[model samples]
Target chain A: MPEQLVFAMEVTLNGLMAGVLYALVALGFVLIYKASGIFNYAQGVMALFAAMTLVGIMNGQVPFAHLINAIFGTHVHEFGWSVPGFVAILLTLAVMVLLAWAVQRFVMRHLVGQEPIILFMATIGLAFFLEGVADLMWGSEIKTLDVGLPQGINLWIDETTFQIFDYGFFIDNLDIVATLIAALLVIALVAFSQYTKQGRAMRAVADDHQAALSVGISLNFIWVMVWSVAGFVALVAGIMWGTKSGVQFSLSLIALKALPVLMLGGFTSIPGAIVGGLIIGVGEKLFEFALGPALGGATENWFAYVLALIFLVFRPQGLFGEKIIERV
Target chain B: MLDAAQTTDVQAETLLEVNNIEVIYNHVILVLKGVSLTVPKGGITALLGGNGAGKTTTLKAVSNLLHSERGEVTKGSIRYRGESIHASDPADLVEKGVIQVMEGRHCFEHLTVEENLLTGAYTRKDGNAAIQQDLDLVYNYFPRLKERRRSQAGYTSGGEQQMVAMGRALMSRPETILLDEPSMGLAPQLVEEIFGIVKDLNEKEGVSFLLAEQNTNVALRFAHYGYILESGRVVMDGPAAELRENPDVKEFYLGMSDEGRKSFRDVRSYRRRKRWL
Candidate 1:
């Protein structure tokens, strides 16, 4: 009984950490969707692109080196000099910002006032374009990223929990750092939306675009700002995922993991993303650990999605999503 | 000596002018056919009409929000404070002290009432002191807003939402406010309260108003001048008192007929034949 209790506690902790990562990715979707009414299927690819750009810049890899070599029949992959990690991150941010502005200017600007489904489909196309661009620019190669994020077990937590039970708690310093950063990010976002003038305009835009415009808030400016912010968030999420595994194409698929988090929380609520991420993270982990063997193992794959499905049937608005009151 | 009312009328200062504007939507539909109106400085000019009578479109054209709906003022001009603003963006219009409070009480539902009011001051480069003072001023008029200031706008009652909408407009410190349907979907008491505040703002702050309203009785009571629109044309224009007493206005708009009781079918047929336009 004691061993089972300790195992449950460890699983819960791990699930919560995983959920924070999901929430981080989900946040990009929330920001873009709320501002422009675009589902932004490209959010995951944005993160992957951001990670690839960071890695390529840090390693001094030549942009479109593969394409350049293919066309000219020359082998050239290195820019001949590597940048420091912090400088590479800054450069990646700059690139993401440029991408955001370009996207708003070329795509979203023309797509304004389009139907929700139409905007959503446009983002799916955007996702493919972004992914292809990232691949073409960075080459389809996986790379290890070391930005000095903490690794190994948190001995202090392990030791502290050991006193409570015969077995100690197992957690990593990387997760602990991620958790702290996610909490800080949430605080910053809430404060931004609540206290700042631009933030209030953002909320207004999310509520009603016409109302926001009538109040002297520039809809395009707000959309671009939201996209830029989402880009930054993608960069953060990419960095976290890249540090955990390696920078690769699959990193973009993490966005799929975030969809369920959005379903549980509500796509429009910032805090909803956090809570939903936590619930899904813990729910999946605990389920897999407690019942995976009985259910032929690998239950973590679909547990979160199935739970979201049930929520959809019972409460489609989601836990924190706005109450949808249809009027004639 | 001229009557005090006549003395006041002699100071008719034009603030906003929409001169013979023709608006088209989706490049095919003509929404506003040669629509022309003027809002005088420091006076309430009411645009009264029923559903689909182009009242909202007229306001949107003045605010330059028509483009969002694929609607364009293909002819004529809209000038604010003696400057052509027919081509200006909605934000630029607001910056020029011409703000429109749209119909349907479009408050930022996710934000608190206070935050919605704050959004109104988005264009103002003025210091926080002035913004705060205006916020206090809004609270003073719609004290109910102060009571529910911390509450999310979506959760507020319709009456309170209407108050938030008007109070939000006041925060912009506009030379003129284009109000639409302030009485829509509100209880009679709440409608009176909202109009009472509108009168207070127009009287005390001297802010000009060009409000589009279907509630003819209420709008005429508060407005100094009124324009009755039909089928995208200004069918009638006169002082508020004259229109209120105008037999056609009484029979059709006010739902009262001096020719005694009439059947519903009789009223519908009269609507077809009494065509003031």
Candidate 2:
């Protein structure tokens, strides 16, 4: 293979890995949006909070340590015992579930049957509140997360590529692992919503709440389940992103990147989220690689948004979104 | 011919009883003002009214679906099988074999026809075999639904969507269904077809119906009993055969007076002098 061709392939492969991460975030958005018609602006913050909670649990840190110390006029942080990563993950999951329940009970319950914009405004408030709580509980510190996932570049791929093309292709082991996990997650989710009784009810609720309720599906139960599933997806995203780059406030900003992804993929589709993520991921990366030098570099950041904007102008319903079927 | 035995049998079994219920939306807009009706077992009871006559509100009150729309029953009681269901959740009503097919054919547009039918079976704990059997039954009744079972329900014609909604309600194995405006937006032929199926379901499946409709002629033709609601109140109530022959119903609803067919202009003064109101 030619040097430029191989380099482009490498970038494309790397872009696909990055796309998987974006899709993971967007999956959380899609799940919540499809079920509740809320855009869930808090999704990125949910990822940040989950990652922070996981880190806090793993390090045996006392929850609300800053408040505890202030009240007592004494220093107390960790419990001085580290928990195993797996146990910590389970604990974090439990916390996420609790969070989901609280959100549905306190926030969503009252807002039932409200306009979409009102529900959306409530989520915006929820995002800020969650971000503040996460900061206060975890003390606004950047923490490195080690979930025992293999890190750094894969030597096997590098050596094999070197043998074939007399050049090494760079690929991160973490990216490969993230890709596999994402694929599995998508398959599991698809199977669940496609086959399960609750899944049908969820889709029914998404389509028409009155009809779903009329058929005996509890809206509250379905909402809680959806939020819990979304929380689980957020946790997965948090783990991957935190492992790549330490858990911090900036991690929540990834939700901003996911906006363009959802716009391309359609907010109501799961597979659209994945396929849209991949398209944006590769398109942005490839665009930057091809035209970066002429444009004075760093076009990747805005390229996805531009492509998504163009899609909005043309196919507003998105790639896989259910088109609004109006009978006149 | 109105059979005396069937009439007495229907009067004996009151499946759903709404006694002088008042429905208020957003805490102020009084939609149903002291409206009352009943659904007898194995009978098609029609709530006949014009637009905004509180027919749908009355049905929603029985099904406990008014709460979601910020509407509530402020007075009187709705009972299913002699048990008060005024404060119950809509899902609880479904569990008790009472479901409402809402106005405007609220089919899960994105779902396939079969999937929409299956969603109606959400509250059923009788297992998949029973559900499958019911699905087959629904398919038998709504043969067109069976043909387009794999197609997205939104793409289906208005008549088909109405069928999807009714068929979905059937999947729950309900003893009584509150069907709202099943004839809306469909051609007259399709309306006849839907009402025919409703008659079949009532006769063969023994499913009771409390259908709200504006098509008085057809509703009177099919319903065992009928309630004529005019602006949040029941102006008249009688057996279908009696209501069909009533002169006021003939003049106002069927557009035929004793002097022969009367246009709106001719009936305007009589409408103002409505004796029942």
True contacts kept of each: 0.82, 0.88
Q: Under the 3 Å rule for N, CA and C atoms, how many clashes does model 2 have?
A: 0
Model 2, position A142, has a per-residue lDDT of 90
Instruction: Give candidate 2 regions above 4 Å deviation.
Output: B1-11
Minimum summed lDDT over a 10-residue window in model 2 chain A is located at: A319-328
**Model 1, TM vs. native:** 0.94
Candidate 1 lDDT, A1-328, residue by residue in tens:
4788889999999999999999999999988877776789999999999999999999999999989999999999897998999999999999999999988898877766668898888889999999999999998888988778898899998999888776788898888888888898888988987788888888889888889889899988888888989999999999999989999999999999999999999988889999999999999999998999899999989998999999999988789987754344
Lowest summed lDDT across 10 adjacent residues in model 2 chain B is found at B1-10
Tens-digit lDDT track of model 2 for A1-328: 6799999998999999999999999999999989888899999999999999999999999899999899998799989999899999999999999999999999998888899999999999999999999988988889999989999999999999999989888999999999999999999998889899998888888988888888899999999999999999999999999999999999999999999999999999999999999998899889999999899999988999999999999999799987887778
TM-score winner among the candidates? 2
Best by DockQ: 2
- Which docking band does candidate 2 fall into? high
RMSD of each: 2.6, 1.5
Per-residue error for A80 in candidate 2, Å, reads 1.4
Q: Each candidate's chain B TM-score?
A: 0.95, 0.96
Write the residue-wise lDDT of candidate 2 on B1-277 in tens digits.
2452236464358989999999899998988889888888888899998899999999988888888889989999888999999899988989899989999999999899999999999988889899999999999998999999999999999999999999999999999999999999999999999999998898889999999999999998888889999889999998898898999899888999888998789788888777566
